[model samples]
Every structure is written in structure tokens, then in C-alpha cells.
Target: MDPDDGEGLFSDAFPTRELPPASAFPGQDPHALGGARDNILEVAIGREVRSFRNKLGITVADLAAATGLSLGMLSKIENGVTSPSLTTLQTLSRALGVPVTAFFRRFEERREAVFVKAGEGLLIERRGTRAGHQYRLLGHNAGNTGRVVVEPYVITLTEESDVFPLFQHSGLEFIYMLEGEVIYRHADKLYHLTPGDSLFFDADAPHGPDEMRQLPIRFLSIISYAKDEV
Candidate 1:
């Protein structure tokens, strides 16, 4: 084996094929999305993929063969040159013998109990550039075969106006006000909630904070979704 022939090693070990351009994927335009070109999520996914492959002593060629993806496409994905779609991610996860969520964050083995200390949760931005909203993922059900999908988060709202668009998802949501006050809007109705107040509603119905009073307000939000839905 020639030490200088990196691509040749893979070609000799497995069959090679040409991959379509990034734009070929549905709704993906490599030249159009500037911010997504090197976004944090893409970078994180690439890093994890590369790390996992290396840990398994598998070369890029091996991964390409296992995933039925072109070597060039795999290279681009591992290098964060492009973001993989959900289908592509699922393929990779299957090839790697891990769940799709593994690309997002590390997964721990199932434990009978878990603990999260105050101010120690992982902050996540699920809503994209939404301002005045801080979300800290308190915890998630771990293990690959965990049936229930429960995600508890600490949400802080500082926006005084209700200009933000309502958001909805498929699941049940419960919110318990912890500090300050806010007008919570669900569907077409609004309810004022203060400390010790709680609201349970269908997450499918559009809901958001109608108003944030007493400056910054903190609350606990627990969302439950079917395991398959996750």
C-alpha cells in the first residue's frame, strides 16, 4: 500500500461511486444557505460521525460501503461541508449501530435514577434564533430502548411583547410557573399565570407566551411524546 495514496486505499478496499451534488438532496441548496454551511449542529454531527468511525477502526471507505453512500458524500458529511438530511442521518445511524439522536448528543445507558443539579442543565436552542427565550434541557430519557420520550426543560422568558409566532408540536405539554409572571396563550385563549400556577395543554395547539411581566420569568416545561414520534 502506497502511503501517499489515501483515496486509493479506500478504492481498493471497496467499490467507489460518484455522489450527486449537495443541492441534489431535496430542499438542500449548498450555495443558498450560508449560515447552515458550517453551523454548530452540522459541525457536531460531523465530529461525532468521524469520532465513532475512528473508534471502530473503520476508514471512510468502510463507512461509505456500510451506509451505501458515496465516498465523496461521506467525506463531505464528516468534514461538515454539508448537512445530512433526516433520511441520511437515519442511514448513518443504522450503519453505526446507534440511534439517530446520538448524532445530536451523547446517550447514556439506562439507569434507575438520574439527577440534575440546579443551573447545571444543558442549554439548547430548539426554536432557532428566537430572542428573549432561554431553554435549558433538564433531562431526557436515556438508553437506546427507552420507550417513553419525556423531555423536561427550564424556560426563561424576557420578552414583554407577544410578537413571537405561536409554536406547536405533537405531544402533551405542561408548564409550571416558577418565578415572576406571564400571560400564557393557548390556541385562541390567554391565561395569566404567576408563581405556583400550572397549565396543561395539548402541545398540538399553538401556544406561547402572550406577555412577560415582572421582567424575566422562569418556568418548568415538561413535554411528553410517543417514543416512535421522537
Candidate 2:
């Protein structure tokens, strides 16, 4: 898939509203879709990023310097103007002392039940080459509870993509290989994953796809965290 090409594999967009609380979903796990299960993960990246920044009282300039990114770029990312690359995200994680997963948190519990169906996943296609490809919402409006988000996705390497940009966010990520194979790049390390194989990693580590992509890879990913804790 061409990064510049806007045509997505799943053409239809998913329907979404605010999610219910973590308790409503049970297990404090975001990966568990209670009703009408589908192949996607729920992510509130925007809310998470803002929460972390606000909590730390970090300015865009401060974050840019710490992440080795330009102030303008960092501002764009925070303001929803641009999507930071995996590498850019890693830089921020290192500077923040929080796991890369910290970039994906929500401070409030969800109130409504939200569902993302196949062929209609909601996405945060912010300005930038790298988009926050959120497959589903873990839970929402639940008062300070925890939940997990499980999603299925395919990583298609572009001819221009020499490496998967390093990224970190605000939770734990469990990746289960489904189809194809690719090198999974974690901070200063690389791991090859195949079908049925899985890996658990800290969200704050700089991670992304390895450059040696011989095929389009598919995987099931679960992200989990407690909203109240943050």
C-alpha cells in the first residue's frame, strides 16, 4: 500500500460514539468487545497524548526538544495537525519517562457503548505520513476504570518506507501474528514474528516494522491500561 495513496484497504469508515466505562466492558480489559465482536481495537490516542502532556506540564517546545523533533512538527502533532512518526513517538517516550504506551490513555471513564465493525473502522488520520490507525475503542465514559483494546491490522510496506517509524504510547501492547511475516522493531532490537506467535511489550519503547518486509503482514494487537490510574 502506498503511504501517499489515500485509498485504504477497508474503504468504509466505522461508526463510533463515546464508549462505556471499563467496568461496563468487564475484566478491566479493553480488548474484550462485549457485543457484536469485530476485528478492531479501540484507541483514544488524541485524548491520551493530551492527558500526558498536561499532567507533565510539558510545552510543545519542551516536547520537541526532548523528542529531537521540530517544535513546529510537535505542535502539529499535539494540535492534530500532523501524525508523528514511530521514531518521533519513541523520542517523546524516552523524554517523558513514561512508556511509549503512555501516549494512548484516557483520564475519564466511558459512558456509552461503542462498537467498531469490520470494513468500517474509525481512524485518526491526522496530518502526516504516519497515521494513528486506530481499529477500535477500548472503552469510554467509565469512571476511572481499566479496559483493553484488541484490533486486527495489516502492515503494508511502501516502496518509500525504509523502516517503520519508532513509536511509543500509554499502555501495554500484545501482538499476535496472524499472517505473513515481518521484523518487529523494538528499541535497539528486532524480532521476527510468524503466524500464531505473539509478543508483549511496553508501549513507551520505540517500536515499529522492520525494513525487511517480504510480504504484507497481518496481526492481532491488544492494548490495555487503567484510566483511573493515570
Candidate 3:
């Protein structure tokens, strides 16, 4: 309005809007913990960063000074108040003497569960399946993941099934006889497995049913191994 008073003629038309508060982000509320579960990355990253910092015996001020960041910014990062950029994370990683991936190690560690309805297990085939053996996978979807791999199958062998004894694989195997009877083999060992009987052994050695002692044999075949294994 006052063009002659060192002010632009359109100054009043383009008024500066007040800036938002430092603690306020677009969608996140720093005070609300209800939405925390949905923001797992924030919580996990904060926990990891704080834990690493504590282990190194350093204060927020020390980290801020080392990373060339302000104390408020570091506090926000540690408190999960803000989602940090990759550049910021790289800076923190360098100052902490740890890899950037170390911050995510605790993120993927979660409570895992798999539930399958009765008779809803996926029908899968194996070496013995062609010989009339039936294999129903109970929890194959969630299996073979994480630090350990687990596969659970409900195996049924009828009278029409042939006696095959040449199953070999990695990891360890466990068999729990649920119905009928069978003479199981593990390498050179022969075990007469009956109802309520259980067998646990290394899977490295060749193993399978040496003989079906009774018809309609049903058992649980569970195999597990380390994730790092070849």
C-alpha cells in the first residue's frame, strides 16, 4: 500500500503466512503413541539409534557435535519425532562407527506366527508323492524365512502307496506318528514307529519308510535348518 515507503506495491496482496511449529509434521503427532504401531520404522530406528549411542557412552550433545547437527534435530531423530533422511543417517552412521544397515537390524525382528485351518493345508508333492504318498503343507507360507527355516507337512501313506526309502535333504527332520505304524529308516537305523511315537534325526543321511508296518500311516514331518546354511 505504501510504495514510496521502501515497500513493494503488492506487499499487502502477498502476505507472508506464519510458519508451522518445529514439533509439528504433516501427518505425525509427536505426543500421540496410538499411531506408533503403524510407524514401526520410526520407533525401531529411534530405539536402535539410542541403544547404539548409549552403548558408546555418549550424550546427545556429543553426537550432535560429531555429526554437525543441532541438538534439537538429534533429539527428534532419537525420539522418533521425525523421519530422518538417508544423508542424515549416513552422517550418524559415520559418527557411530557402525554401518547404516545396523540401524535396521532390530527393525525386522518381529513376533511371527502362522495358522492353518484343518484340511486347508496346501497339497504338495515330494519324491514319495508319485509313489502314492500325500503331503499337506501346514505352514509353508511363513516357513523357510527369518533366521531359521521350518517346514511342517502332514504325510499320509495308504495301502496303495509303495515303500520308498530314499529321501535325503538338508537340515534336521522330526516325525510324529499320528496314525497306523511304519518302520522308518535313518541311514542304517530302522525304527518301528507306531501311534504316539516321535523320531528326530539329522536329515543329511538318506532316510524314508523302510516298510509300512500298518496301512493308512499318517505322521508329521517337520524340517528345520539355519538361514545361513548353504
Instruction: Per model, state how many residue pairs clash.
Output: 0, 41, 0
Query: For candidate 3, what is the TM-score?
Result: 0.56
Q: Give the TM-score of candidate 2.
A: 0.40
What does the lDDT read for residue 13 in candidate 1?
43
Q: Please write out the lDDT profile of model 3 over residues 1-230, one tens digit for every residue.
A: 22123234434653323457875657756688655464478777887889999999999999999999999998888887888899999999999999999887767765556799987788987878899999999885244346877889999999889988788888999999999988886665567789998888889888898888788999999988776774
Evaluate residue 129 in candidate 2 and report its C-alpha lDDT on the 0 to 100 scale.
34
Model 1 scores a C-alpha lDDT of 0.76
lDDT (0 to 1) per candidate: 0.76, 0.56, 0.81
Alpha-carbon lDDT of model 2: 0.56
Clashes of 1: 0
Candidate 1 worst ten-residue window by lDDT? 1-10
lDDT of 1 at 222: 98
Residue pairs clashing in model 1 are none
In model 3, what are the clashing residue pairs, if there are any? none
Q: Which lDDT tens digits does candidate 1 get at residues 1-230?
A: 33123354445544333567766779745568654434367777887899888888999999999999999999988877788999999999998888888887622322355689989899887762266578898878745466678899998776533334387888899999999877776765566788998888888977887666666788899998888876
The TM-score-based order of candidates, best leading, equals 3, 1, 2
